[model samples]
Target: MNLKVIAFDADDTLFINEPYFEEAEKKFCVLLEDYLSHQGLSRELFTTQVNNLPLYGYGIKGYILSMIEAAIKVSNGTISVDFIKKITEYGKDLIEKPIELIDGVEETLQALHGKYKLVVATKGDLKDQQRKLHKSGLGNYFHHIEVMDDKQEINYQKLVKRLDIQPSEFMMIGNSLKSDVLPVLEIGGYAIHIPFHTTWEHERIDHKVEHQNFSAVEKIIDVLKILQ
Candidate 1:
């Protein structure tokens, strides 16, 4: 494949992440249950989150803020301060949640670690991402860690340039086709998609990918066959 630097997305790719957010979201919906249906509340919360993206960027902290904002909106300013506090606590609990590595994650990394110049090219709050990586006990597998604020074509371009590798020499593995696969493929890099059970709405796309460099696998362990 002529790949030298291989990157992986952090959140759902390496370990469990979406379910934590989903669980927190359920609590948030219940907090506002008196105001709206759970589905409606979830929609409102997502709208608030998307609107606040530029101000807060992407992270659990911003998500907490979105929940609070949405709660206030849904409750028409009648939501109690105690409930707001609980919402904040939800974000905290998420941050403190244990690292649960995806099945076959360690085995996959163990096989590919030294063979490839591995990296974590992920998007999120740097501190939280760092904490998760530390907790995962998979730190030594990577040659470098890039906890970027976002992952897009330009961002991937800059990353490739910084690493001094040609676009074609880079490979990315992740669950999100929007953030991880398309962008890397846009820059002429190879990307392998390892789908997770839950995907955030913002990370979802409708079109099918038709790139020679793009591939999808059934699980993390399946990556071994393609890369080998």
Candidate 2:
């Protein structure tokens, strides 16, 4: 493959992300357990988050709002402000959470650094993503960072255009097959799925993905074998 640009999906692909969110979600469910069962609250929160995606895009701020919205809905619009404050705190803590790189992430990046133009191509609130990337100490390795609103076929097409590379010369590596893999492949770019143990419900795909340009590896470092 004549790859010119190697783009990575930042969140779970590069560092620990979803597990923290899952922990916060567990707390959210417990805080509202008096109004609804844990399972029920989870369902409500997930539904609210998905519904609010177009409006809030993606980030801790949107998540805090979704938590409050779900809590209010579960409490029949009578949820207390104290509860809201606690929810806000949860979101803030997430925003400040430490960046813990995946086991082989830095090693992989170091190996591939000069061989190609590396960039981060992930979707989320721009400021928050920028903060995480800065904190990760992996920023210098990337030539650019693209915090997309959403990862779709058109978005990938636009990214390819912006990079001035042919679709065939772009390769995306990420954990979510739904967001990071399918869209890149749809736009004729190569995709490598490095499965994270936890994934957001909205990013889960129900079926297997098979394509000539798609491959799944057990870990981030495995990409070196394929790319080299």
Which is the leading candidate under lDDT?
2
lDDT of each: 0.93, 0.95
* Backbone clashes, each candidate: 0, 0
In candidate 1, stretches whose alpha carbon ends up further than 4 angstroms from where it belongs are none
Q: What is the TM-score of each candidate against the true structure?
A: 0.98, 0.99
Model 2 C-alpha lDDT versus the unseen true structure: 0.95
Backbone clashes, candidate 2: 0
Summarize candidate 1's per-residue lDDT along 1-228 as a digit string, tens digits: 899999999899999999999999999888788899999999999999999988888889889998999999998999898999999899999999999999999999999987989999987788999999999999999999998878889999999999999999999999999999998998899999999999999999999988899999999999999988
Q: In model 1, what is the error at residue 79, expressed in angstroms?
A: 1.7
Error (Å) of candidate 1 at residue 68 is 0.9
lDDT of 2 by residue, 73-186 (tens): 999999999999999999999999999999999999999999999999998889999999999999999999999999999999999999999999999999999999998898
lDDT of 1: 0.93
